[model samples]
Target: MENRTPIPDLIRLATTTADVDTLLQMMETFCHHFSYPFDRPLRQQLIRQMLENPSLGSLWLVVDENRPVGYVVLTYGFALEFGGKTALVDELFIEEGHRGGGKGRTVLQQIQQTADELGVSVILLQTEKYNPRAKRLYESIGFVDQERSTLMWKRPN
Candidate 1:
């Protein structure tokens, strides 16, 4: 007998408005876990936008035996430095109970495959400095620190 980690069945691309509620709920949980502010209206709007225009990105739901266990948000971009198409792993959240069972790694592997198929020249992601576990997981799967600070600016509303 051999022991094997079960491969999670991730819903690769969320393509309908029907997934909004699940996405919002999971996103809220993710925000809380990371101590980030949860803005329902803004998040809802963004989810709707992504659903309406897949060119913007994709949302993947991690499922186990028909139950939703986690979700991932991947957004697209283009940069001359990256040779054109790029994908950002905007968010990846595995429910608390589902963590540490290889689900996250499996999902990331699938994401990489999808990106390759889409002609993405690069895949990028950021992890919170406070979450060493996540950083380790990412590094174990071939994501490396770019050795550059990531600065952001939000336009005034």
Candidate 2:
């Protein structure tokens, strides 16, 4: 028999209550890595609220040996441009010590598979322009740069 290794079940949807603490810890790490200051209590409250609402978004925890090491968030939208449903990979973060060993690519592939299963016609994401390493990984996985438009955002005060 040919030697075959089991495919690891690393990517999984985060449970509303069961995975809240793990998700929060990963979110804090993500914010720190990207230099975004957040109010912990408010953030926690928001996450809890979102967990109760399925339409808000979906969060997945990347685990190894049943312990979470990273997370990804996908927010949904409906648009005629994409012919139906679309989703944005809002955030993807792998802990400091757990990075740079193909985990990122594995997680992305799993995301793609999940998108296919969820009837999402399009999956979108953006990274800083200067982050060449991330850009390369995204491209390697068949994500193309959209040249026709730029992403803009507005924050309500």
Candidate 3:
């Protein structure tokens, strides 16, 4: 039998302003690790928006023994191709110290279960090309590569 780490009991939704700071700190760490530029102001605004509107999305803090270990973000959208409501796993980060040991896999499994309960028809996510470890972890949890290229256009700043 394979030994697995039990899911922590501290996965809590970020529903209050008090959670913003903690989320920002963790997000900064995540972006830095991935070499993504951290736009603090924009991220702060987006986080607040999600908090104010449950219909928009949700943010969850992954905690272990009362300390935050990582965070996940899910944004809701409607997709005809998906047959209706879809969830984009906008961000999922497990701190370096907490990497491995089955935490990431467990969290993703929980996300799928939650999405099903919420009537989401599909869940989508993208990983960086350089981060094969993350891609493998996601695939191990049943996430598949759609083989479609993703393109984005940012509004002129």
Candidate 4:
């Protein structure tokens, strides 16, 4: 008889400088896939800062079979509109081959559980309009379209 047991998905928080390399690799892969601009040095700095400061946010590695296959970033914030603590899913990416098999949704469920544990009132994320697949996934997971305000950003020179 052959034994079969389902492999449990793991979400491990990157809590030290040691994990930065894997996180960076995942980030680079994600950026390349989406054609998003990336500055390696600044990205490393930001990851380090987040690791050092719990209040800023968290970086997590999604592992299966002891190998990191993806990563997710959650940045914390305070908002009166949300009525308390809130978080933004800054980035979520599952490596090319590992996607489309429920990994992304599993990671999101883990994030929501963590948010509940931390008293986070809301979890927000954005996806490119051109990517209907992503938008559909988000919608399926209960994230509604925000019709009120357009998200705008300004960078200080």
lDDT of 4 by residue, 1-157 (tens): 9895543556889876668998888899889888999889999999988988978998999988878899999999999999898999999989989999989888887888789786799999998889999998989989999889889999999
TM-score comparison, 1 vs 4, better candidate: 4
Supply candidate 1's per-residue lDDT for 66.
67
Better of 2 and 4 by TM-score: 4
Determine the backbone clash count of candidate 1.
0
Candidate no. 2 TM-score? 0.89
Question: What's model 1's overall lDDT?
Answer: 0.86
Which consecutive 10 residues in model 2 have the weakest lDDT in total? Answer: 4-13
TM-scores, each model vs. reference: 0.88, 0.89, 0.88, 0.91
Per candidate, the number of residue pairs that clash is 0, 0, 0, 0
Candidate 1 on 25-135: residue-level lDDT in tens?
A: 999999998889999999999988988887888888888786788899989999999899999999998899988988889999888777778789999998887889889
- Residue range 21-132, candidate 2, lDDT tens digits: 8888888888987888967898788777767886877888988888899998888888899888888998999988889988888888888877877789988889988789
User: Rank by TM-score, descending?
Assistant: 4, 2, 1, 3
Q: Number of the top candidate by TM-score?
A: 4
How far does residue 78 in candidate 1 sit from its true spot (Å)? 0.5
Segments in model 2 whose C-alpha atoms lie over 4 Å from true places: 1-7, 16-18
Whole-model lDDT values for every prediction? 0.86, 0.85, 0.87, 0.88
Colliding pairs, model 2: none
